[model samples]
Target: MAPDSTPPTNEATAEFRAARDHLLQHRGDIEGARRLPRPEGAYFNWALDWFDPEAHGNDDVALRVVDLAADGEVRAETALSFAALSGRSGQVANWLRGLGVARGDRMLLLLGNQVPLWEVMLAAIKLGAVVIPASTLLSPEDLADRVSRGEVRHVVAESGLTGGFAGIGGDWTRIAVGEPVAGWLSYADSAAVPAPFTPDGPTRADDPLLLYFTSGTTSRPKLVQHTHRSYPVGHLSTMYWIGLRPGDVHLNVSSPGWAKHAWSNFFAPWNAGAEILIVNQPRFAARPLLDAMVRHRVTSFCAPPTVWRMLVLEDLTRWRPPLRELVGAGEPLNPEIIERVQAAWGVTLRDGFGQTETTAQVGNPPGLVVKPGSMGVPLPGYEVTLVDAASGAVVTEPGAEGELCLPLDSTPLGLMTGYQQDPERQAEATAGGFYHTGDVAFRDADGYLTYIGRTDDVFKSSDYRISPFELESVLIEHPQVAEAAVVPSPDPLRLSVPKAYVVLVPGATADAEAARSILEFARGRLAPYKRVRRLEFAELPKTVSGKIRRVELRGRENELHGSGLTGGGESPARGKLEFWEEDFPRD
Candidate 1:
């Protein structure tokens, strides 16, 4: 109904589309745009209401994926138009319906970045099924936990990954994509199914749609439940944050099964009617991705800090894609990387803040003046309040730090209902009359929020709070250091001191000289209290998603090689390859 500027048939789509168009029209008006219209309706279905209506006769490229060719210079591309995908998904929906996939049935999707993944996502939405998008990287043990906890009724997995489910006890429907499996139904059969599928009934706005498992870095993964409108409608804020526009070729460097993949791939760009581009390589080679961006005429791009860090290492001065917006998420982007990218591309690498539990709450939208080290103000329809965890005081003064939270009374549309089957955890999240983000940030005088670190990640040194991210940001600015993770090391006098576990760039020396130079660099850039006192040249542990697992490093430091109460708190004997600041001369 909205494709040709016609009136929308669905009340939810009408309300969502209105707010979406408003954000696009007034990209610069953050305050005005933040006052987004809430959907006032009893029933809503994004696939049926938004996608189908918007797909009518639309021939624009909806999705295009590129992989590196053997030559490595050229990209092998596959594209699908909006109308084509709409019809394809419709056929898949009908086929899946015949297989007994019904409304509210929890379906697990275990696949990679293939066309079938997108088709299945749309088809599941059309069939009113709850989808649990899972990474192919998860172990069989992890899959077992998800199956048991998620109450999965059906699973759509690649043929290669079917082995992981062999021992899992369940009569769950098994469907495979690619090469014929002995007992699993083939996804190729959907191609022969008739189109023009019909839904059983209208979907209530609060009906469950997506169930996400948080990437467990610190603890066990939490099951985050989102309604039909929560993710489908909630991503309007994400759309606005990314500065998406109709016909824009938006490329988000995220994989299947992640909330971020759905955020930019399924909802946010579609909310803005923008084309989604996915780039795949046998291994992450920045040149191929760079070539694809230039070849496809990419307009907007979003990648995690890991990708951004890798990208700046390439000779970016040579390739200038037609990118208008550059965004970073999944972690805070270092100022050094942002500066390097801006120097080459002349576009600011804007950072956005959100979680698996919600959509984009805050961001540096396109055209907003970039504030170095800040992850912008709140997005549309979100009212953010920073709360002090210790005293339960609302932190209003600038430069003050607190936990980012949403008041329960004014909950935004993007937030999850709660962690599924975990009442105690959910209770803790909603404790103190606010939905606690568990992450901490500091607000500046101009309302820009600079992310400090996770509540657990932030530590104290000599009664002064130390933000690992803040210190890590400065550490990466050193020419040879590629990545860094800071954790507290026990000390007698200071009680604890900042110690950095550093990873050096390729071919860089991992010696005392390198450590001294890196430490000197950080000491010059950081305050005395924040300076890393102990440095070790070692690899940082990461989740499968490429997030640094500081918790692991903290464990290593706490044990300190199982040395118990030695050295009278002066200092533990320096471990192999570890360097203390006092080991080097001040000169």
Candidate 2:
């Protein structure tokens, strides 16, 4: 179908457009963008109020998914224009309504990166149903927990994943996306429904829209609640951070069911009227990924630090993508990785900082001076502050480290309502009139923030504070190291010392020589007190989302050393490939 010859104009859209344009106009000027007024109103439904109107008769390709074969060859491809998607989602919405799905009902959406994921998201929004996105990697146990804790009233999952929910008990409707499932409704039947979906009622700005289960790295996952305005309208800051523009093809390498997926794949790019490009691969191969980027001419790209680290291992200069902007998030990008990419591609990989509870709060937006280690200043619409961890007072002196915080006095629209059903935890997080991020960082004189580590991840050695991220960053710079996690090793004298769990790059042997080389490399780069006293060669424990679970490593260390006594020996625990500083002969 052809796009509408002319775009529709309305007051709500105009307000959103104005706010977006203001940020784009001042993309390089952080202070100026922050000064712009935030968009506000009572009644707003992004799908109906913004997306439908913006997508009407819009022939521009809004979504493109490139499928890769097992051999890393491009097998099949699909593209959906904005107008077609708007119309299709309407049909899905009408069909879902016919199935007795009502407004404000919670639905569990479990699928991979496919067309139905986008269709169902839009359909649920149009129907005013709350969505809980679950990763396909989730186990049956995980599904049951979500079904119970999320109060899910409906489920939309791929046919292959239906079995995972077999033993799960829930009073929800099951809708399958692929081939025929016996007891579930077929999602393919939505096409038979009519277009032009009509909402039962207006979607209020504060209406519950999404419930996200955070990746449980330390404890059980926390249920985060977001309203209609929280993600849809909130990602304006994310769009600004990525420097997205209308018609730009933006590709973000993130898995489905994560907040980053919604941030870039759904809200950020769509809000900017940009095209979302996806390359579906059975497994990630850097060569195939770069080929897709070149084939699609991806203009703006975002990926987690893990992807960036892997990409740098390959010859990045071989493929000169037409990328104008590159970003790294999920974890802070090391300075070495950023510099290598800059040298190869002539484009600096900007670092961004945010959690599932919020949108892009800080980032190295385009046209700004790229800081070596800092994750840039606060993005537009966020008033970021550094508060002392102990005193709870805002830290004004530069170079002093503190807990990163967002004051509740001017909470950005992107911030989540709170941890769902956990008022006590919420109160603790929001204590002192601040939304404590529970992350630690230090600000420079120029207001740039450099991530130290998570508050819980930081430890003390001989009374000196040690940030694992700082040590890990230096450790990865060694050629043999692919990934490293730092945790506190119990000590009888200094209380605790930094210990490293190292994952060597392919072809690197986990021998005493290799361990000595890594420890010596880090010893020269890190301070005396922050030196990695003990080293082990093993795969680091990680959350499903790929975040290192340092807490698990700490527990293992304490469990091994029950008495917290090393006996002044070199190898504390035997048979675990453990290496210590004393293992090497002294000059």
Candidate 3:
């Protein structure tokens, strides 16, 4: 099954490789990377043009997956070389084409971090079929919504998850992996068809390639569409921002079916010719994760802020992996998490900002001066502009707060074409010539941008604007506090006040003493206006993708503690274990 396939000079491939090499050569210089040229391929396919050629005769481990039990015990592990995957994907592509899959076909990919998941994705790319990545955690209702809205004509799901698609009402072809299914085509059947895949025609760069469902923390998930070039070619910034180098072992702790998975696991690593190290655990345990990092000799690493926060709780000094680059994404990273990692590994855990709608727009790239609590400067090719939400005027002064946005007319290749079939939402998002990110931030004099809260998450207290992120960052610094979410609590005199919902670490009780300790710690660090006036300890609600749902916290506060004049007409009942600033004694 060994295939030595190398396509000749493709404009897209050549252009992409040049940019990737330029970024790697000048990893320490942001300005040099910003000068890297964008790709201009009229017809391009990343799998055919970039990956297949790069993977030709290359035996480097492209993907390494380690599965662990709930107690951090390794159960199963797998590794695949670049050449092996390329050949296997070609077989899958040829097999899929025989099963009626055609160009522009829509496919729903619902699986975990298994080898087949990667296989189908590359196969779909080679076949010119659009892919919709859905989490395995989704229920039948969630799958139904995606199936209908995504116009899915083919579905490739894990065998156990096929039941969720039952009676979902789609004419789509059903294919299962992992085991035999009565009415499904086995993905295992692809092996029998040995002919290598050949594309019917050139894949237009503008053709739809990937469709993503946003992790809806605030509202219904939006359908995000990416073109052939958007994610495949657009993640050069992400690779550069992560300081990805060829032949390096890169570990991105993320789940499949999410944007970060594609950004870090699939595209970014392969673009750099690096190995993607995956750790699959039944339950996340810090020790086993650290063990894998050290055992694998991981060079570059990326994880969500939640994972970093948990890692800091363990004895960080215990294992020092040979990690050259570290990054935190998914949410704005807390300063405490960054500091602890730096102390333990002597390498700063940098933070980056991006979303399902775009690639890494802003980040603290490698060799840059790491700034405390700042997400750092805009990555190359992203022209970041801070605009005042109310006045619609560009905010130029340092320390001035504004909505984080990218100019629409000059939008980068990474941005989604637009929210699929939702023109109203698309227009609203692109109002005023900017692809509004709906996130707020303030800039420093030296041009490093700090992430404030989301546009809806930010609130006004006593006529002063408040950023929940600013307060929550200080809250997690307390030893007792594991995680924190800040929301505005209704008040009679000041309209609303900042309130915090805190999650304590293991074995920490949610009692008056614990609340007092966190409150006192935050009071010392935060300003008077942003002080958390009320505190409650509870497990924070989150989206399936692990993002904290601050919107739910805001609703709970309004429904419970709204003022007599604000919304609720009478005094609201206090939540159990809730502690207030007034409940503590005066200094």
- Stretches off by above 4 angstroms in model 1 are 1-8, 69-75, 561-575
- What lDDT score goes with residue 315 in model 3? 90
TM-score of 1: 0.97
lDDT of 1 by residue, 1-587 (tens): 13455533666678767877888888888877877777758888998899888888788899987777655654567899888899999999999999999999999999988899989999999999999999999999999998999999999999999999988987899999999998899999999999988899899989999999998899999999999888988999999888888999999888888899999888999988999998887788787788889988999999999888888888898887999989989999999999999899998889999999999999998768888899999888788899999998999999999999998897787999999999999999999889999999989998999999999999998999999999999999988988889998877778788999988888899998898898889898899989899999887788777789999988888778335536457666665689988889785
**Pairs of residues clashing in candidate 2:** 3-57, 4-57
- Listed in order, each prediction's TM-score against the native is 0.97, 0.98, 0.97
Ordered by TM-score, highest first, the candidates read: 2, 3, 1
The Cα local distance difference test for each model comes to 0.89, 0.90, 0.90
Residue 235 error for model 2, in Å? 0.5
Instruction: Name the runs in model 3 displaced over 4 angstroms.
Output: 1-7, 563-572
Candidate 3 structure quality by residue, lDDT tens digits, 61-95: 99998999888878999999988899999999999
Q: For candidate 2, lDDT tens digit of each residue in 1-587?
A: 34456566567777787888898789788778887667787877889888898898888999999999978788889999999999999999999999888999999999999999999999999999999999999999999999999999999999999999999875789999999999999998989999988889888888999999999888999999999988888899899899998989999998888899999999999998899999998988889999889989999999998888889999999997799999988998998899899999999899999999999999999988987999998888788889999998889998999999998997676999999989988999999999999999999999999999999999998999999988989999999888889998888888998889998888999999998999999999987988998899999888888888999999898887756455348646542788888899658
TM-score result, candidate 2 = 0.98
